[model samples]
Target: MLYDRIGVGYAHGRRTDPRWLAPIVAALGDARTVLDVGAGTGSYEPLDRTVVAVEPSAEMIRQRPPGAAPVLRAVAEALPVRSGAVDAVLALLTVHHWPDWRLGLAELRRVAPLRVVLAYDTRRHADFWLVREYVPEIARLELSRPSAEQIAEELGADEVVPLPVPWDFADGVFPAHWRRPRAYLDERVRRSCSALAQAPPAAVERGMARLRADLDSGRWEREHADLLAAPEWDAGFRLLVSRR
Candidate 1:
């Protein structure tokens, strides 16, 4: 419920970047009827597909565009539709938020007539730049979020298509921010992440100060120069496309 209110203007700040989208859209692959589970403000949906969104957050639901897919107010643990109804199920960056992960996965298994697509960062990768130094509080906050391997099991996914994507300020929401330190310093971008949302404000303040000093002293650049150009880091962001 708390994440429902994450940042006042996310359509832009946390807008979906195309680098990740190209592959995600590919994974969704020709499914005419798609179910976007935990669809946040209808961010990653493909405009061409017929999408039915299920989200429990009132705040997030209201942000969906007027012409965007139809939305249903429901928790992931229990879906309103009958089994094997849709061509695919798509869940992105959201399994960690589920109160009952297995229950939600069970529902996912029950639905989706043929295939399912999912994206979530691995908790182990939370050690990326800001998460480890400027946002230690966020690291601790994310510890409870389930791992990628766990999600693979829950989806009963025959295979999870592997796509390693990273995010820098130049890119979208991703861990490659490990490469671009400046973006994490931005208030709007930081607001999109859950760990930052859960951290104590004072702790975040202190962390940011240290991060600022590192940037000012040229330490950050010297340390991660190569990363700045490196296209991707394995931040545990995995995509699972399942077939029924």
Candidate 2:
């Protein structure tokens, strides 16, 4: 799988962004038991709850910290747990990676009474400046991934919370560094973001060269300086909350 190949160092750049945690935790409500589907490195698995993580990538599972939640090597389409076995289930920024998202979502609904997913609305990908200017290929790839609305409809989501990306967001997802364009130049940053890792090397190189030039020439700053003062920006991320 793509994750098993590039997910070795995922934990280094994929820590939970505390700013976004509030909404996730709140959406989790008072659930006592939770299943973390596609739980890469156990990021965002609530410590307060009994979290059994479901991860398909052994490399990603190996990267989980020592004290992280216990994990089961399984895919979201077929959870080992029985129907309605957990209070809640979480699929954080992972729905797009599922080979069978519809089946995976069905498994989530079957395994728990409540479902929470942090997913991107691909329709809004073009609105992001980085995708628009630097890496148009990311947008092309995003077309294959289901949009947030599609996922919400599949899950019968009662609420879709907008997960605004703070200027200095801690998580290293592709859009997390929107306000800090220079972060894209860092190899470790790109390594952790699936978009850049999966993109054609030639395309990535071309985008990076343009980005580097823009930064060096102050054109990037001049064009996006307004973002520096903004507290946060909406990058089409949404927290889909549903109950069976």
Q: Which model scores highest in TM-score?
A: 2
State the C-alpha lDDT per candidate. Answer: 0.74, 0.89
**lDDT (Cα, tens digit) per residue for candidate 1, span 103-207:** 888888788855455555556556777767676767665777887788887676776766666544343464546666776678776676666756888987788
Residue-level lDDT of model 2, residues 93-176, one tens digit each, is 999999899999999989889999999888677557877898888888888899999999999999999988888888998888
RMSD of 2: 1.1
User: Any runs in candidate 2 off by more than 4 Å, and if so which?
Assistant: none
As a whole number from 0 to 100, the lDDT of residue 55 in candidate 2 is 93
Model 1 lDDT-worst window of ten: 167-176
- The CA lDDT at 54 in model 2 is 92
Number of colliding residue pairs in each model: 2, 0
lDDT value for candidate 1?
0.74
Model 1, stretches more than 4 Å misplaced? Answer: 166-176
